[model samples]
Target: MKAIANALIVTIASASSALAASGAAADEGGFLAPLFLAFGAAIIAFQAIPAVMLLGSMVKGFFSKKAEAGANAR
Candidate 1:
């Protein structure tokens, strides 16, 4: 549990720093700025969304299988 807590802290810190740096970079640009930022965001979201969806499906599958097996034994 403590390890998990530490991991969460580190993830939060890293994400904050990364976002701060990206924000600073974006602010330095002119016209085409929002477009580039949106492109980068879309790429990141595309990658993250599929993995999140897969994780959710896996968790749901695990419980469904467990329930089915339990019901079969009864």
Candidate 2:
């Protein structure tokens, strides 16, 4: 649990730093600025997929176990 909390803190810090850097770069307004911004947004969006999937699986497992236990009791 402590390890997970540390990892979460690190991830948030890293993401905040990347976003700050990206915002600074975006203000420069070159040809590639929009492209880079879009790419960064895409990367963040893609990263969420696995996290969502893992959370979904955990919720499903928890409910399924409860359902089975209720059925067994009946």
Candidate 3:
């Protein structure tokens, strides 16, 4: 899907940039590594949060009142 592809692209780019920044900063200041690390983590979390919500909604639907009502109506 397009969303998966976009996530992959973003993850790859973020990882690459983080690595680059980390290496550059290691030679001078150590601050950028943590910043880039946080950036990469945030990117991954953003990508995963939607999927987690969607899966939670799907699981909730299986136990929901609406599902019971629909089953009774059938």
List the global CA lDDT of all models: 0.85, 0.86, 0.85
Clashing pairs in 2: none
Q: For model 3, what is the error of residue 66's alpha carbon versus the real structure, in angstroms, after optimal superposition? A: 8.9
lDDT of 2 by residue, 1-74 (tens): 99999999999988987777665544667789799999999999999999999999999888873545666684
Give the poorly placed runs of model 2, Cα more than 4 Å off: 1-28, 66-74
TM-score winner among the candidates? 2
TM agreement with the true structure for every prediction: 0.41, 0.46, 0.38
Whole-model alpha-carbon lDDT for candidate 1:
0.85
Runs of candidate 1 exceeding 4 Å displacement: 1-28, 66-74
RMSD of 3: 17.1
Quote the RMSD, in angstroms, for model 2: 17.6
- Per-residue alpha-carbon lDDT of candidate 3 for residues 1-74, written as tens digits (9 for 90 to 100): 99999999999998997777655434744799789989999999999999999999999988875645666684
**In angstroms, how far off is 18's CA in candidate 1?**
29
lDDT of 1 by residue, 1-74 (tens): 99999999999998997877665544557778889999999999899999999999999888873545666684
Which one is best on lDDT? 2
